[model samples]
Structure formats: structure tokens, C-alpha cells
Target: MPVPSQRYVRNHLLSILSPDDYEAIQSVAEGVALGRRDILIAANKSITHVYFLESGIGSEVAATPEGRRIEVCITGPEGIVGVPLLLDVDRTPHETFVQIEGDAVRVEATAFRRLIEERRLLRGIFAHYAYVAHLQTAGTALSNGSHTLEERLARWLLMCHDRVDGDEFPVTHEFLSTMLGVRRPGVTTAIHSLEGAGMIKARRSHVQVLDRDKLKAAAGDSYGVPETEYRRLLWARR
Candidate 1:
């Protein structure tokens, strides 16, 4: 395969591609815009395509029988949105949605799967990504169970900022409450705490990061280690 443009290679699994492997799959790719709150994949629905986000944030969430939603994981430029394709499954158990409007490169699932079989390096890279996702799930469990609302909110915002490539992104406190598995009031309080500390400036539908170090501190202890490991081990891997 020919080497793809550096831009595509800079996103998620593509970055891990050997030059030759990148060349092989580059031609089939197409880019798409993702709207805010758009459903990328529905729970139990057949996985038709996989997306590599060039911009924006995606949330992987599970809904309970009583209609409660909690974010289990997140995806951005550093990861693909559809994990079921990598796992050789047709449908995902959780729903994936666009958290912030952005664009992505998408390929049909069948093509992706066939391509993976012929590309050893891509397979290894994606396998490592799956492990990272597992780690994220574990981290979320710990954050929800042990961390304070303010800390969890900070961690979530920092993660979003890292993925979206900017300090400001479109997000509502109400939506954040759902992601944090807390009530809207809790989200409001946490937002105020971060804002008071000068870590972020919150508005109607956006929050701009001001002091990233302070935001990281507000995320507390547990969220930091695993997130740091994610950047070091999974994203930094060739």
C-alpha cells in the first residue's frame, strides 16, 4: 500500500499503520460530518461502518432498563468509534453518539474486516486499542464508585478537550449530567467549582478550558493515572 496523507495517519489506528499498510487502505476511505447528538451506532444494531474521527468527541454509553444512561467510554481522534467491527461482531451492546459536532473518515465494516485480515500491523494496533478501551471502562468504574463529582467532571472535560483539539466544545450541563451519572444539579455544582478555580469558563452550551493543570488536579488521583497510561501506552504506540 502507498503511504496515506499524514493527516489521516495522525488519527487513531491509522497512526499505527506501517507505511505500506497505510498505502493499501488509503483509497477506500471517505470523510463524513457528525452532528451533535447524532447516533453513530444503536445498541444491538448491525455495525455497518467504522469511523475514524478527525474532530469531535464520541460517547459510548449503556442504558439501563429504567432509561438511565452512563458513559462507559469515549472516542476521539485517538480511537475508532465502532469497536464491534474490531471484535468481529455485527452489533454493539452499547450505543455510540456524537458528543460534539465534528468530521470523520468512514469505511464499510466488511472492507475494514477484510483489510485487517491482510494487514498484520493494523490488527496488532487495533488489538492494543481494544485493551485501552478496556482500561477506560475500568477507569470509569473506579471514577464513578470512588471519585467525587467535581473530580469526575474535570476528568471528563479534560478528556473531551484532549480529543477535540480545543479548549471550547459544545456541551450542555444537562448532557454532562447524564454522562457523569449524576443529576443536573450535581453537574451545575461541579461546573461552578471548576469555574471558581479558573480551570474552565462555563456558558450555556460551551466550556472553555483555562487552566488545564488545575483541571487535571480537580480530576483527582484515580482518573489521572489510567488516563496518563492511555496516552503513554496505547496512543504513543507505533
Candidate 2:
């Protein structure tokens, strides 16, 4: 019910906008609290609003008719939700939901569409973000297809850690399994392996990064390319 402070406006895409461009949309943007597992964009449904996360993580998931789900990409303050709207689409087959509780700045989809059309810089920022999202999705596909469970889990943890404010966050084996499209036992085993290697410490319903460098090593080449690309495209000038 209260207004979000300027400090809460940490979404990278929004932050990179020129001051004039940001102010143009600020009047229409409303802050909202997002709860864990909150559905932001439902598959096959028209998107009503687009969210620029101020904190926490969102998962873009792909589902099959058999009710199986696999995460295609993870977004946080570094990205935006409702990407299909940017591509001139009204709906998508992929669903997006909050993987952790956080806050976001939201704008009506129509307003957002209009704003981008009227502002070249804003439109360019969103275009860059969409390309980064594509790279992240591609990275996920490569990880899922080629990496080991432990390596993939490490990569996921590194991604989450980059988005959160601290070294630790709450996550369960079941949730990890669903995100990774692996069995629960496989997630458990991977968690233990990371913990044993001192790459992370797992507790009840949480995981903490102990040695990020080692974790990156465990993730091998699956973790850094998209991150480097994001920084190059979006954050370098800032």
C-alpha cells in the first residue's frame, strides 16, 4: 500500500534507462509485493501487466501435457517479466512465477507497450534485455543437455546468488528437482556433493554459498557467458 522508495528501483533494465525515459514511466508504475510461487504470467493467458523485479527471483517454466515442468530461465532484479508482450504477442505457452518472495515495479501491459514505442532508449533497453533472456534460455538448454547434475545445480545456485542480496536463500530439494527437471534424490545427492566440496552449505530449507569461486569451478563453463554478455550489453556503460 505504501510507495516503493527510489532505492527499491534496482531492476537493471529500468536502472539503465535515461532519467527522462525513467520518469516518463514512473508515474504509471506501481510497486507490488510478490509472494513465493506467485504466478506472474500464466501459460495460454493474456498478460495484463509487466513486472520489473526489485528483488528476488522468477522462473520461466516450460510445461508438458503430462504436467511435467522444467525451468527455462531465471530472472531477478536484473530482468523483466512479461517478455512476450515486447515481441507483440499477447500470450505464451511458458508460465512465469516467483521463485522467491520479493517486490517489483509493475505497469499495465498496454501502457508499457505504448511507453516503449514512444521512447527509443527505453525500447532499446528492453530489446537488449530480451536478447539477454534469449542467451540465458540457451545456456539453460545447454546445461540441461550436457552438464552433470552437480554441475547444473551449482550453476543454478550461482545464478540465484547473483540475484539475491546475501549468501543464503531458502530452497528445498523438491523445488530444485522441479527446476532442474531432475529427480528429488538427484537434487539431494547434488546438494550433498556441493556441501561436501565446501562449495555450499545446505540446511533445512536453505542453501548458502560458502565458496563462490569453487562453486563457479564446479559449474565449469555453464555459468559465466550469459552473465558476461548481460554486463557487456546492459551494465557496462553505467
CA RMSD of each candidate after superposition: 2.5, 1.2
Off by over 4 Å in 1: 1-4, 7-10
lDDT of 2 by residue, 38-91 (tens): 999999999999999998899999999999999999999998998888899989
Alpha-carbon lDDT of model 2: 0.91
- lDDT, candidate 2, at 236: 90
Candidate 2 regions exceeding 4 Å error are 1-8
Candidate models: Cα lDDT each:
0.83, 0.91
lDDT by residue for model 1 (1-238), tens: 2323856455766766777776666767776888988998889889888888877888999999899999999999888888778888899779999988888878888889998888877787787777788888888999899989998898888888888775788889889889988999989988998899999999899899999998888887756665676677666665
Local error of candidate 1 at 46, Å?
0.7
